[model samples]
Target: MLFVSRAIDKLNDTIATAVSWALLLAVLICAGNALIRYSLNMSSNAWLEIQWYLFAAVFMLASPHTLRRDEHVRIDVVTGRFSRRTQVWLDLLGFVFFLMPVCLVILYYGIPFGLESLRSGEMSSNSGGLIVWPAKLLVAVGFALMILQGVSEMIKRVAYLQGRLDASAFTKHAVTPEEEIAAIKNANHLT
Candidate 1:
């Protein structure tokens, strides 16, 4: 289970690192396009559309990384009061019962959506824009990654509950400024 979790984490980490560069490239494209349009009186619909595509790609592809890093938003006001073990159980239940089902549904719908786009060779309505199937495919791929990450998280949570893992083994969300400061101090101490 730990091996599976680590592999999933590493995969997401690698993908996230790569997608981050795409984000930077997207920003550069946007800036360059704007400059060309304003300063040189030139721009292409394709360029504009590519900006949106890259934005969507960054958001969709980085989701697993966000989940693995514990950066996804949560309603912590209530959960913060629970014991850590209780929180683990809640996370497990949420992943197994809620997150997993949603991902499956998205994947179910996404495949046909992407296939239809591919079959039609769908292009953006924008002049000279890229094909639509690739973006549609990201929906399925993103959800699949999300589902896999959820399973990895579930395995870790269960292992923790079973006393096979320690509290420090899991990603910890900082609930307060003090916690964040303490974390920085601990990190510094480690070095």
Candidate 2:
């Protein structure tokens, strides 16, 4: 189970890294398109649509990585007061009940939506705009990845509760302010 969890984590990590670059590409495209439209009086619908596609890709694809790193938003004002074990249990419950069901629903609808678009070779209504199916397909892919990451998180939580994994290895979201600062410094190789 742990091995499977690690593999899922690795896959998400790789995808997240690519999505990060995609975000940068999106920004550059947006800026360049605006500059050309205003200065050169030249722009294409495809250029604008590409930016939209990259934005969608970044938001959709990076979600699983966010969940895997425990960086997803939480109503921590109450949960933060709970014991670590209680928190783990709560997280497990959230993954099993809330996260899994929501992802499954999205995937259930999203996959067929994408498939139909692809079957029809759906093009954007805007003149010179990009095809629509890729973005639609990305929605399904993102939710699918989220489901995998959720399973990995649940497995790690169960392992922690069973004392099969160290608390440090299983938990990730409890960094103190000082630890966060130190981490930033270390990441930059600063003294």
Candidate 3:
């Protein structure tokens, strides 16, 4: 079980790194497009098409990584006040009742949609003439990753519920130094 958990953690880390780099590339592409449009007064439809494709790819690819890192937004207004054990129970219930089912649905639909796009050789509707099947395929790939990560999380949560796991065994969320610095800099009273 430990080995399996560790392997999942490694895969999650690799995916996160890849997503991070892809996001950086997306930003660069958008920035370059903006610069060209503003300075040259000439638009490349390809640039616009690439921008949207990158946006879609980044969104899909980063989803599993976000879930793995517990970065997804939640109300947490009530969950924050619960005791640790109670929170564990809530998490278990929520996963079983909500998250898992949603992921399964996405996986089921996204696969066929992506496969159909590939089979039909879908291309961008833009004048840029970009092949869009690859971006479409990212949907299935991302959801599949999310499902794997969800299963891993469910395993850990079940272990916790059964008293076979410690709270520390689960991944914890914390603000990084960069985020801390950004927060400080963005505070209105800081200046």
Candidate 4:
């Protein structure tokens, strides 16, 4: 269980790092587009569409990372006061009943949706816009990653509850999303 959890975490870390690039790229493009539009009075649908695509890419890819860090908003007031075990159980139940099902349903529908878009070579309604299938693909990718993280979390919680895992190994002492982002910025010399 520990190995499984660690592996999932490593995968999400790698994916999140890659996904972070989309944000940087999106910002640079947006700034450039704004500058070009204001200065030269020139703009293209492709550029605007690309920005939207990048935004969606970042959002979709970042979800697993958020879940891995347990950074998603929850009713902390209710759950925070519970005992640790109870909290874990509640999280597991929520995922099982709500998050996992929702992700699976979206993933199931998303694949065919993207595939049909690809098959038909779908494009945006705006002239000179980018192809639509790639953006459509993000839906399945996002939910799949979310489901993967959900399973990883459930495994860890179950192991802990069964006395096979250590409490410290979970969110007790973990590097947060903010810390990770700061580290990435520092590594890139952005600070």
Index of the highest-lDDT prediction:
2
User: In angstroms, what RMSD does candidate 2 have relative to the true structure?
Assistant: 2.8
TM-score of each: 0.90, 0.90, 0.84, 0.88
Residue pairs in candidate 1 whose N, alpha carbon or C atoms collide under 3 angstroms:
none
Candidate 2 residue-wise lDDT, 1-191, digit = tens: 99999999999999999889998998998999999999999989999899999999999999999988887999889998999899999999998899999999999999999999999999999999999999999999999999999999999999999989876765565778999999998989964
The whole-model lDDT of each prediction reads 0.89, 0.92, 0.77, 0.89
Question: How big is the positional error of residue 95 in model 3, measured in Å on the Cα after superposition?
Answer: 1.4
Worst 10 contiguous positions by lDDT, candidate 4? 167-176
Instruction: Show the lowest summed lDDT stretch of 10 residues, model 3.
Output: 1-10
Give a tens-digit lDDT track for model 4, residues 39-126.
9999999999999999999899888888888788888788879999999999889989999999999999999999999999998999
Candidate 1, residues 1-191: lDDT per residue as tens digits? 79999899899889889999989999999999999999999989989888887888898889998988777888888998999999999999899899999999999999899889999999998787888888898898889889989988988898999899886766764678998899899999999
Off by over 4 Å in 2: 173-191
Winner by lDDT between candidate 3 and candidate 1: 1
TM-score of candidate 4 on Cα atoms, chains taken together: 0.88
Tens-place lDDT per residue, model 3, 16-57, is 777677677878988988898899988788777777777777
- What's the candidate order when arranged by decreasing TM-score? 2, 1, 4, 3
Score residue 17 of candidate 2 by CA lDDT. Answer: 97
C-alpha lDDT of candidate 1 relative to the true structure: 0.89
